[model samples]
Target: MSVRSLPSPADDPSTDIPPPPEYDGNLPFAAAGPEPARTGGERLYVAMTGAIVAGPFLALGVGGWLLWGRLIHPADLLLALGLYTITGLGVTVGFHRGLTHGSYTARRSVRIALAVAGSMSFQGDVIGWVAIHRRHHAFTDRPGDPHSPYRYGTHLRGQLRGLVHSHVGWLFRNERTPADRYAPDLLADRDIRAVSRAFPALCLLTLALPFGVGWAIGGTWTYALTALLWAGLVRIALLHHVTWSVNSLCHLIGERPFRTHRHDRATNLWPLALLSFGESWHNLHHADPTSARHGVDHGQIDPSAAVIRLLERLGWVRDVRWPTPDRIDARRA
Candidate 1:
């Protein structure tokens, strides 16, 4: 070309100059991205707790007028006791020890059975239960512990309030331990994750199953309705209190025979032993989290341990972490 070409923007040396700083596209004091949205799950959890608590109070008012008065039926009492035992053991043995703690393995069939039975208790999905429990162990009586009774203080009034706080009030709170942090293993398990997601359906079945059984047994609508009240609602309420007591009463008022950190006030309350499937041996549990047998001493009467033994005998479970004499002695205070 005869004419000299003007310097294009890209070819020009001055074009390399940095652009002027502009506030149009960015904030002067901006930090990173916005925080995550709070889940509405806590509202649902609070509603659930309220319903469970209110159910018992209402039942007591009505049932006292009906059952405890001249209309009492022994079958109702028996049904309550029987259902409580069945579902209580399902939570303690099947959910806590077997699923959450992995104290012992189970056959595929036993695993499925325990999952179903535990779901019938209406506590929660296996994964959520395990997640909260694992967090408790990871931060026993500390800031992150899900239901530490000592969160209030050491004074009598504070401790009393804390006891109630830990026992049942904590369930109404919105705070939740992260599933990824505490229960990644369970979260990764397809079966456990699925079961956890089916919690509402399982709870519905928990109520309905007792009603169906009562109908079959008594061949009457009244019997079925009464059974649902006693076995389903009352049983759930009672078990809820007993289990929550371990987190509250067991920690606050028992003999700490097994040495542990001062902050970890886990103790064995003998009165709750039989009813809790030997979980009242709390001192030994904190001392040795992996032990399949919590009631390690003679005459401790761990029904759960007995069941584990039977399962092991049948080759349904292996590699059980049973307590040894040395281990027990080492943990003695």
Candidate 2:
């Protein structure tokens, strides 16, 4: 199936999902507060964020050394692929679509399981992640957005700087998205709270699991080390950039065919489609946030939607807000 093209005017989709709260374009574009002073707790937070952002990068050098010595193993590649698919889906399907937007109603067990899986991605606790994302939606590409590529401005120099800021720099900032204000539903869910609390432990396990499995399969510390590098560190890093690309590149680049709120410039970036589980069809997501499917047009592959469909078929989820042809057509530009 080919992707359908629409004309250059926009229409709103007819769905129950309300548009994100709109803000007038009067807020300051620059960061509003004095730089946060780093206290003991703040220091630790920055240190951990640094490690999460940089550790996988450092692993790339070590991986290259291993490859030079013929120490790379097929099991490591297989393990990395498996873990990447699982955790990536956990974020795209569970954290973003299900929890953050209520795209579908999952069974209690399924909901908790997806939350646990997503926490292992080392992104953040589920509640915090959802809260931050909700805030982004509420103020997309405008002043209050946590990571808009347009944060700096629309000029060339600012766009370049904003790209870096949106891609990863904003993670180190002290800006906080309050759960009570943005994600009260997740905050009130006992199962989700437990999963959020387990985030640190899950981060450790995400690394250690590959090591133990590698040793079991390959029978050596060398094997375990390689698995730790590729499956553990490299996989996390790859997913990090892919997810961030949705925030940065998805906004500044690609085709925008759907009507979103003023200043919401989300786009359909097909190059990132498979790796991001169809989330790169971000224009549609911003156009109709509660739709169970983002890649509503022909030939736009959306693995997360497929997973949600499977769960619905298995009775693990219901009330999926799948888009109809009319809804899709109405959203055309």
Candidate 3:
């Protein structure tokens, strides 16, 4: 005769319960291998993007040296800064927070403004941008993610490859996120659809507006050209890299103060906090995706949050998802 034995977790293979879908201490990034071979068009697009962005910058440097004092105009500098601020907020507040995450609800007017501003960033059309970003949240750093730096393995070579791929290489890939699946709300809205259709025209307007402003202020074609260079090309390039950094560098470098869904490697990149308009607090973002304020911790300085708060006060936006202490604490690692 023997005493009845108590059943244990290891007693039967079928009895093993899977961890919560959120996280179970599994490492997925390390396991993800290199992505598929990039096509010729993708490579060409990458090359052209590099050339267009870098070309103007090189010209600016060389021209600045040749015409140092002439190139350094107060009006040009201010114009660039102004466009950067307006357009950057449009993406952060309008595209990423409002449209993509529904972090806050905005009036139709506010929504249109944000959509237009985000388009000024020249990333993509509102519908497509929201779809891709929404898909990013849905898949994160997992295999299905469109731009995870860890698409390649976690080894040194793989990390480097992943970094480049995530930074700007993935843009060349022809695979687009399905707007129908990821952004049904945007698709249904007539205003959003109209904006999507006019993205190409808006891209031109963003540049033209700056040039016109410069021409009017300085009363010269030279000034208009310079503003086009600085405020249009250079500013777009800078903003592009900063936003892309949130995708690439934030995943690979910076602090992971909060734990996110399983295998998500988003980190709070402080150096980019200001430039990215508080988007660099990416770890907190992934941890609490619905929270409007990404830079939740003390002294985090989230300008986008501030803008949202202003909009809330002005009655332009409603249902702002400001983070609560309990919510923040729950996501802490």
Candidate 4:
């Protein structure tokens, strides 16, 4: 029996292959992960989704301070920070690790809550989000990767162009990765499908939630509006930039402790450790997507992993893919 050696990460399958076809519905999880190497374009007709929201965010933040002498109340500050923690974990733990990679199995209720909380982050609908992310992994830094920062050549102008596109310009794109091809398991999950559909409603609810709490506490419209601006808009803006930085800065400049043979440009940015919910451990993530804990080393803080650990103790998550020493040693650059 001839055992096949794993392909060197430097030797990514670069040829364009057709994306996997849709199954006849209800494919099991193990069989549904994206296969290797598949694929298109540059454009300026992008929808600018993030920019549109940021305009309003900046306006509210500055205008409120100038006119009302208050940009955010103390309660508003707390509300934003608290919600940011929840929704950020929802993306890092729930969406990226649990749902997208099956890094762990969560209780049905916990899974559902994670999806709902992830929707509150306003990143994308569940199915679409999974599809785009899965496609990103399947292609990595190769041509077909949806968010590769090296889309343009590595020359100065090309790098600049590529950075912009990868960071947020991709948001303007009308092209979407087909869920059946990249995220078939999520598409097949009824809970995920429902959450994907409820994205718009969830957005409304998330934004309104802080306002409601503030109004109830203070019994004033001023407090309600202030909370809405800070917790709702400003918080979204902050998380957006942090999440986008993974696609942008993490790929460009950071410590590459885990060598991936240039298959992709993921790096671990220690500065982003806390802000990104431990997701700045990017090189490790691309090296082993199924590992539930990305910050594998001692002294590295991973609040999301801590959450998963707590849940595991409480029987809320199982089959966590904590990195073993052997696995870590094998992947060291």
lDDT score for candidate 2 against the true structure: 0.85
Q: Show the colliding residue pairs in model 3.
A: none
Return the candidate ranking by TM-score, descending.
2, 3, 4, 1
How close is each model in CA RMSD to the real structure?
Answer: 16.4, 6.1, 9.6, 8.8
- Residue 79 of model 2 has an lDDT of 98
lDDT of 3 at 280: 96
Ranking by lDDT: 2, 3, 4, 1
| Candidate 2 residue runs with Cα over 4 Å from true position | 1-28
Instruction: Output the better candidate (1/4) by lDDT.
Output: 4
Better of 2 and 3 by lDDT: 2
Query: How does candidate 2 fare on TM-score?
Result: 0.91
Model 3 misplacement above 4 A: 1-70
lDDT by residue (tens digit), candidate 2, 1-333: 000111111222321234334433333375577876789999998898898899997888888888898888999999999999999999999998888888888888998889988898889999999889877887788877899887777777878888999999999885888888777777678889899998989999999999999999989998898899999998999999999999999998999889887778899999999999999999999898878899988899999999999999999999888999999889788
What TM-score does prediction 1 earn?
Answer: 0.84
**Candidate 1 residues 1-333, lDDT tens each?**
100122222223442233224312111212225744646776676687788777865766666676665554567678778777777777877777777677777776777667767877767777778778776776566555678777666667768777888887777765667878656766666776677788888889888877888888888998787888877777777777778889998888988889864357888999989878889998898887767899988788788888889889999977777989998898899
TM-score of every prediction relative to native: 0.84, 0.91, 0.85, 0.84
lDDT at residue 36 of model 2 (Cα atoms): 63
Residue 254 in candidate 3, Cα distance off native in Å: 1.0
Better candidate by lDDT, 1 or 2? 2
